[model samples]
Target chain A: MNELKELGEFGLIDLIKQDTINDHSSVVVGIGDDAAVLLPTPRQLQLLTTDMLVESVHFKLTTTTPWQLGYKAIAVNLSDIAAMGGVPRHAVVSLALPQSTPAEFVTNLYKGMKEICRAFGVNIVGGDTVSSPHGLVINVTVAGEVEPANLVCRSGARPGDVVAVTGNLGSSAAGLDLLTAGEWEDFDFAWPLVTAHLTPRPQVKLGPVLAAAGATSMDDISDGLASEAHEIAKASQVGIKLYAKQIPLAPELAEAAGQLNKQALDYALFGGEDFQLVFTMEPGNYEALLAAYLDLPVVKVGEVVDADEGVTLVDEDGQAQKLEARGFNHFRQEE
Target chain B: MNELKELGEFGLIDLIKQDTINDHSSVVVGIGDDAAVLLPTPRQLQLLTTDMLVESVHFKLTTTTPWQLGYKAIAVNLSDIAAMGGVPRHAVVSLALPQSTPAEFVTNLYKGMKEICRAFGVNIVGGDTVSSPHGLVINVTVAGEVEPANLVCRSGARPGDVVAVTGNLGSSAAGLDLLTAGEWEDFDFAWPLVTAHLTPRPQVKLGPVLAAAGATSMDDISDGLASEAHEIAKASQVGIKLYAKQIPLAPELAEAAGQLNKQALDYALFGGEDFQLVFTMEPGNYEALLAAYLDLPVVKVGEVVDADEGVTLVDEDGQAQKLEARGFNHFRQEE
Candidate 1:
């Protein structure tokens, strides 16, 4: 057996899928999408999503605390539920821990998770605990429910629906910059941004709210805006145009980007793990959505177009450039 | 900052649970049962189950092929769906692989899964792929659906309900013995048993059939007969009595156990990961249940009894001996 390094991440994933057996009848969609779908009963659907975060691969233990890791693990799955406009009911966490990890570190991690679950009313029901060969590996599975009428699939957008986002973008990416540069205190007051990057608060409340308000389609921003927009376009058989000028950038994020000689606007557009809700609405419902989120900005950055046009980003100067997805791909090499 | 080894698995699990928010309304039960329960939509019920198998913790890389691992990973989860009297519909697998693993090995694993999925008509829908810090970790979530009226739970058994098991028992454990002892020839013809241990075949077909035939309650025998019986007994608030003389043991298993001077009967009772369905049915349905599984032996093992009596196994001499749960507890060292 030659090393797995030779196969690369994408090759290994493709290989695994090739041998997978799916025998269940309730599995509406498996092994190929953002999540797995099953209609457990007539008129009721269940969505399950699981992700594994390993040390160094997904996070660095030296820089990331167990609490942040624990919170992020659950937050990511909750984001998946948010993407589907479903309410998360339960989560099972399986952890593989190193023998040397401190008990307090583990407890702190759970405390972070408890804080998040309390906000959203999600329960930690079951999980497995085993010793890891190396660092910690956390796999979280969240089960959520949706009525058929309220399910918001990524594929449901219309050509002319407006592309809007729940909150400001790029703050998380900017926070990562501060952490990487060892300047946590410089942006100490911006705890929400740092927490957004480390312990994302998924828009669980906003999902069903948007669905009730008649959003045409939706997804959570785990990947950058560019990547996620591409997904919606592909799924809905439409193209999307993102207005560069309309994307809001946090002031500190702008300063951080300037110091690094990078555009904060770019981060706002392409940085990932914001965990904010992004969805589309027709011209009619747009006003109510704006009214509902008046205190919190829901920026309308673009509009959906026919699929043949492809995705493009328009500058304030009216110059347009075609956008290709460049956000995180788990199978790709780490920076 | 005390080490994880001091806290142990249970302590760690409790720590993790304490940290979670656990507020989701869809979760009827979480964190402690064989599987979590979600409130079903009217006329339909959904069952979700997940299991993670680490390379060394669950299997020996040298002894278990990637193909067998893939098959078993999904099979075990399917067994959980079967336990709920649900028909499996889809599976999502999350895999963390070492950098050195071959793509071919991964592909072979999926090919084995494809074969099983084809046989059972399950769909591979979605999953995540990541680089492991060390050896491989495979986590699979299976989703299934059942009619609201037909779903069975561990808590539904009542006193006087007969305890029944599908097919023979202890073959898988016996086959594992052969694997450990390297007596290949003696088990050459017992591939079914070996496969039972290596690649579990969840009673997917029997799930709905048993539900339709009015199984009072059910659970899959993953943690051995005695342990699972104890679980059902505890949850149902009842006790159980087993007629040891009437317990069905595979012929090959009996011979192998006899050769090793081990009690084949005891192995059948306490060995784990059989993935067979152990259920209870009203005595009035016994004849119909027996006739329904005429092609496959459905052995009557015992009866649910009052909790005060506890669990007991009656010997051929008509003496009742107390049955202790000696099945697998992954957190505890293997005996």
Candidate 2:
């Protein structure tokens, strides 16, 4: 654990540069410059998204490694691009680290980010590194390209659209529960849940697939299904009706929820950081999309309704209840 | 002053969105979307840069207002775009703030950033806001476009190229001195220097002008003239010879330096945060560049030399000495 001060800003940057590999053809210049130069793809609109993760607020260093933290930082920003039905191409990461941080931690952090970038075919272009008086801060800005015809925005969902999601929900929250309880190792079923919490994969491919299948509005579930559905509903001036039973939850998540003495449905509806795609499409296109993704874990869990109807959830008893957008808020007091 | 927790994250974002005015036609989608959609300019290369500023490290709130901090945040990132000879089109600002901060401070901060964005014809596109346990961290990512033919890089300098800078040096450092001394009000002549430190303008227009005028290589002087010159030399694999007497200094800066019992040349050579452009151009193109920028303050301060000659500063006494890069490093211990 070499102190960050011993490496200096330039030294840390050099270590990062040595590990970075640029594979994108659009990257005319990458790293070691004041600014990165990228060639634009003809006939494609560019997508840009930025996300910041602060220590103690976004993550606890005591429970997570620097590597996991770095991966999550890039993954969250990439998820934003995924939600836009765009193909991520380049990223710039700005890190504010305390002097007491170890040089090895910084190196591993880059390694974690690089792993995801390589998997997604994104290039690490340029960024700034500065010292913080306390705690670690990471900000990642991702740039991607999207064909105008395939682009999906949250404002396009119409009444009578079918709402669907990719993969299982609530697992990330359940995993977090196991980690917080220190019972992750006690149950073999908790491994998947813990991994989901630590390194949740972004639905980057599912976005484009759904976009081509006529997804009218799409958003990644970073703030849980209900909250994300609320965003789409508000943006499109429509209402959302989610079927509680239709929502998918992994067995591991169910087991973990049971261990925590909580209902799995609650986590599925309100637990954030799922990194799954929640999309809305016309009912006519739902069958075709499902058929196209038959091998994938795509589930139709809801339908878009008129704005006057309001966002709601229908339980097994056929009772409709108004749904509150109870998602994560940085400044909100935790219950 | 209102507590940041009272406003919450979404409330703060709404405040920022209300103050933001988009003027760029390239921005098809700005804030409120998962990602910003930008129309790519035809046949142009894209430029991207990110900069992070942390509290108590990059600045102190005691001496500066939130408005100035916000303005400086955007300005610094814009400077990186300017250094690349690109026209800034969009900017994303990520802020990590403590909950104890005032809502009014956040509002004023956005106003400051909006002020600069409006002046530069750049749009505020997308960003993220997160809570920090302590202190403030601001990260800005700027995207711009540049013509491939007019793009300039630091690796293009040649041995016979002339080294020149736009405007005077050391004024920003002198202003910082005045600010630290708490005598900024007593010296009328120090006001300009103080303002320079507070809000150094990015030479956005001059970069393209110099690029068109055949600048071989260029970089903005953020880490003092000597350090920036070394970067160009190392990148281009050439030695640089700076004429100490020819380095431009503001009259106010000289007076401030004298009052601090420091040589004006020392301040001009080693003082950081100048926010000026240091460029290298062919000797033949220097006359045309000067003619083109006749109204602007452009000065020839040095010349590129053979690598064997090393980086040197020739004194007025006709003696040359090696120039060590003595710029500020965030992790380096102060001497």
Candidate 3:
């Protein structure tokens, strides 16, 4: 009886991977990647990814609408496709609901999912519905297509490449704080943060843009920046140096952080669920990519370094500190 | 606040489909089908489907091992691909487990899944693992491929088609009864029934055989025969006449039923989770198909009639009676 808490999430995943055998010749990339890559034809590669959102562990119906829950469910899965620089084409959703749930709530949930799927030109496919004795569970699987040449993986980063991110960070974490504190409506400035937590949008359109701009490596920022940076660093066998001042923080997050009496930078660095893109590219392509997304909010936050250098964060005073890979660990009791 | 019980499963599915819009040209078929059909390549059609098994609702951990649970989870999804007459290529599994669950339990679970995937040459590609506040949930999504010329849908049956079923029926339901009886170990003849309920094999090999033999309408029996029969009849706009005498029952099920003092015919008609293929083919093609599977157990149990005739069952005495679709309804309180 080895407790899951002793193994942790990553440890459990490693055990799962140990027994996984990729016997199919059509499998271009299998269990270790962000999305499973399959060569269905000579022309295109197919990407398959799945995500699960559990009640209480992922969300609470009291603070969130079924619509938001449904929207976020699909959005999170789409983020996986985006991480692999693929165009999401289809989605299948499986839901387990308590018998006490409302009929309209389920309908509204699908409406929310449909809204996101339609916005990205993805089609809702087949699904299974079953009754849960307790709690609500949503599992979404997204299938996408990518050209082999344009596909980006987390392992492609090289030393001296610049690390960049799309949109702002810490807003979702800040929003989650606001939701936890209650009375969020009293502070009108905190509404955006709250909405960011409830309905964080996946950066689907930005994936192909970065891939076309010669971005070497990319991953979605579902976990904190430090955690995701460690993933890219470990996968690419490179070190990363993040500049604290350069990390993008939403203005609303600053106000909310102030109201909560916390440092905004801490949230920007460690708060996750932003669903934004983090990527590395050659120094020369950084400016060109920035120029291309001039209308969008993109920023260079760091640079990839030699593997021996390790991952670190540089403060405003030029002090370098090791970046601890701390994020939400599902099996960590302390969390 | 309409209760889910009021909507039922089909009503809820209808609501879900109302807002679903297919936006991708590659999506040949989306929601409302047994599996979503996609033209991933011009050469092969892709079939995608998903199924979820939740704690207590789908299985009892006390009576079943994590390995059996995992095996059955993937097997059920493979059954969906079989229903569409496709060869499963890849699978992604997502699990939500409680922190208290044993790490070894999770490992053994994946081991079970790996065994089945390896046997079928299906790749266990990618998955997500997260902590649930309570209970264990497993969701499996399978992607399969089929040639357009060999594809089979649930709507292809017409009048004069013979309805046939592969393998034994009602054994799983009888197995469940034996499991609940607490002294199942005392009866050596009941071992097969118990194993059938614990690890029901999916009919993957038989699907292509039927499709190659010109089978028209086909579905895997997840719901009871009555419910699945209604599905094919409704989809094909035809009536089904099931012959009670022709329903194949395993000898062990008869012994178990005698011990339980219940009618074996009732379980044969309404018991579910058999994972056997129920299909219809032109009367001319039926004989050849049966001859092809002569070494295997196949039975011709019914025939398709005009839509106006409705679905019915002819008892041993040749009296026709309306077949009630009293299968497992997730939201039905009576279930």
DockQ of each: 0.13, 0.86, 0.19
- Per residue, candidate 1 scores C-alpha lDDT tens digits across A117-142 of 66776666445555666677888887
Task: Give lDDT for model 2.
Answer: 0.88
TM-score of candidate 3 on Cα atoms, chains taken together: 0.88
- Candidate 3 chain A: worst 10 consecutive residues by lDDT? A28-37
Compute the DockQ of candidate 3.
0.19
* Regions more than 4 Å wrong, model 2: none
lDDT string for model 2 (B205-246, tens) is 888888888999999999899999999999999999999999
Q: Which candidate, 1 or 2, would have the higher DockQ against the true structure?
A: 2
lDDT of 3 by residue, B189-255 (tens): 7999888888999988888788888989788887779988998887788999999999998988878
Q: Residue by residue across B1-335, what tens digits does model 1's lDDT show?
A: 43333333233334433212122444333332212334444555555667778877678776778888888888887787777778776666677876555556666677666567657766555556676767888887765667766677777789999999987788888777766777665555456667778987889888778877888888888767898888788778999998988888877776778766688887788887788888998998877777766676578999999998898999989999888977865434454
* Rank by TM-score (best first): 2, 3, 1
- Of the pair 2 and 3, which is ahead by TM-score? 2
> If you superpose only chain B onto the true chain B, what TM-score does each candidate give?
0.84, 0.97, 0.87
Task: Look at candidate 3 and give me any clashing residue pairs.
Answer: none
lDDT: worst 10-residue window of model 3 chain B: B28-37
- The prediction achieving the highest DockQ against the true structure is 2
> Best by TM-score, which number?
2
lDDT of 1 at B165: 91
